[model samples]
Target: MRTHNTIPAFGLGTFRLKDQVVIDSVKTGLELGYRAIDTAQIYGNEAEVGQAIAESGVARQDLFITTKIWTDNYAQDKLVPSLKDSLAKLRTDQVDLTLIHWPSPGNAVPVAQFMGALAEAKAQGLTKRIGVSNFNIALMKEAIAAVGAEAIATNQIELSPFLQNRKVVDFAKSQGIHITSYMTLAYGKALQDPVIGAIAKAHDATPAQVILAWAMQLGYAVIPSSTKRENLASNLLAQQLQLSDADMAQIAALERNGRLVNPDGLAPAWD
Candidate 1:
């Protein structure tokens, strides 16, 4: 497994998945050798995910669990308490990484206020590392100012073959903040692209593997989610696929700034 700084380079993402679907996904992923798992407060599946982990019988040290703080608990008074609640639901004492799901809507909570509280959470052992997701360049700067660049582990964003997000990636790299690509496959949309298909055929690999390899080759962490055991098993092999420089260039040309995970009112002005 590749790791960008402190964050695992590849893992499983639980976004829209819920109930039995998510439970099976997490259970199968663990059975297939996925040690890192990503969940969020809004996903409402932490308890189910925690149950899968507990029943898996894997040692806690062998797993790298990550959970996000919902925007509703961004205030200084509520952030740590909320994280403790997440820990309770996750059935773990501390998350390997804790992230702000998204920037507060309309900046209802200033960046410093929540960043400080997040740092406090780290000091209290609520999380081993801290990060922010879906934050723009401006918010990143404010976050860096609030807690310093070293304290910020990563800036998870929506990056795929189509929406490479080079601008944000560049700034995050300049500040030594790792970038985690949430929807690296663009919700299976990239699997249907002709360019990606040809590349997959050239390597005798699946389209999903080609796209995931492209993202991992670029040094961005990926957490692709799949309900099927076959997909979960196949996706883990992406870490071993190496793309040639020409192939990387070919995939780079597929960028159209395509972003698929933007929620109205919840998403910020992306870079």
Candidate 2:
């Protein structure tokens, strides 16, 4: 239940999960002692996640649920309505955190408008914390400057053994901006990676576990998703697997500026 400064370090990612798959995954994760869960409007499974949480029987306060507003909802006018829709679908009064899914480049709405909406949401108790996702260093600077540092809490992005994102990570650390590493498993690509495999074997853990451990060691929150019960259980065990400094160094060398979640034109330049 450790948080990255403020947000939790380990959470269940419900990115591609849908229908009964998402429901079962959330339920299984909760039963396995997972306290954080991440979802988004674009993921199209918020309702399923909501149903699972309501049925889990865990008190609402014990869970830290996070969801995001999609890029289409970035405008000031669209912000609250989008969040309200998400809240209704999640069957919750308010989320633990709400993030701007992406920083749409050259959009008509100013960063201030979106960030202002986020602040208003926090003030109105729509979410306890407000953050951004897929924002680079420049965008982060603009966001903090506009919102004032205290208002922004985190930046969720892709961080794994292959795509290290060192510059952004270091900047975030220096600025005391928490980060949530999505695609920590690299969309199942890392499981077969030779470097990650060797490291996992050395630690007597799954590659996913090793990757997650690497992220944890760097103080970045991670949300790795899996539908199977065993995968979910094993992923949670990643918290207990500690990699040695030497192993960490070797894993660090494995970074080749690789990424698996390329959404083509839809995604902004991450480099």
Candidate 3:
């Protein structure tokens, strides 16, 4: 699914946080050695994320920044321009990765149109890589057909112990597309599971660490977000936690098709 692991296995995600909260979170994550920062147009915090990165004094070359284009920007005419706006808000000339935030609702914009525009964005130096988010198996196939597998860097989706999304995962892996697991902790839901709790207790690790390690161990990239400095610091350390085969199998059984990010009108018919 990856060649040289272009996407970082762990990073910071900015979703609901805004203003000083997001600014502080990005700054804190950077101070804790986080290099990859994920944001989206709908997140409404790109400017603040840019502010934090600029203030952190971290060299631009050392960071991997990603932002997604909203569904409204899926149109061929709008996609590249929308990404240019994102670059301006991000205070950078180009983003390391840019994704189609979601499949066009009701096929309002065809995949080929937007994917071609995204390819243009890359060709014009607007982004280093291009991909999609919240895409199901069928949508992924359309994207691959539109841009070819090698052009699609990743398919960021809502995945966790609860919603293993094996159908989508298996298909993506088969197609050689990387899966970026957003809300990989299931928005903190899996942290409360007794199964995960037991594993964390056994390893003397936090439930978040156990979940993150489990995903990375399976070769999925995770972007878990936190606002508190302590939480952010501790979450970054999950990269070090390793779970045994028994632990992995235990968590795999935790799947129950639980998905947390599906939205009305915006979500596609999932795989």
- For all candidates in order, the CA lDDT equals 0.92, 0.87, 0.91
Overlapping backbone residue pairs in candidate 3 total 0
Clashing pairs in 3: none
lDDT for each residue of candidate 2 in 1-271, tens digit (9 for 90 to 100):
2243298889999998899999999999999999999999999999999999999999999999999988788788889989999999999999999998887656556778899888888888899999998888888888888887566788898988889989888887778788889987777777898988988887789988999988998888999888889988998898998889998998899887887766754466665
Where does candidate 1 have its weakest 10-residue lDDT segment? 1-10
lDDT tens digits, residues 57-107, model 1? 888889999999999999999999999999999999999999999999988
Which segments of model 1 are wrong by more than 4 Å?
1-5
TM-score of 1: 0.97
Global lDDT of model 3: 0.91
The better candidate by lDDT, 1 or 2, is 1
Rank order (by TM-score, best first): 3, 1, 2
Clashing pairs in 2: none
CA displacement after TM-score superposition, residue 151 of candidate 1 (Å): 0.7
- TM-score for candidate 2: 0.95
**Local accuracy of candidate 3 as per-residue lDDT tens digits, 1-271:** 3563378888899999999999999999999999999999999999999999999999999999999999888888888888889999999999999999988889999999999999999999999999999999999999999889888889999999999889998998888889999989887888999999999999999999999999999999999999998988888888899899999999999889898888999899988
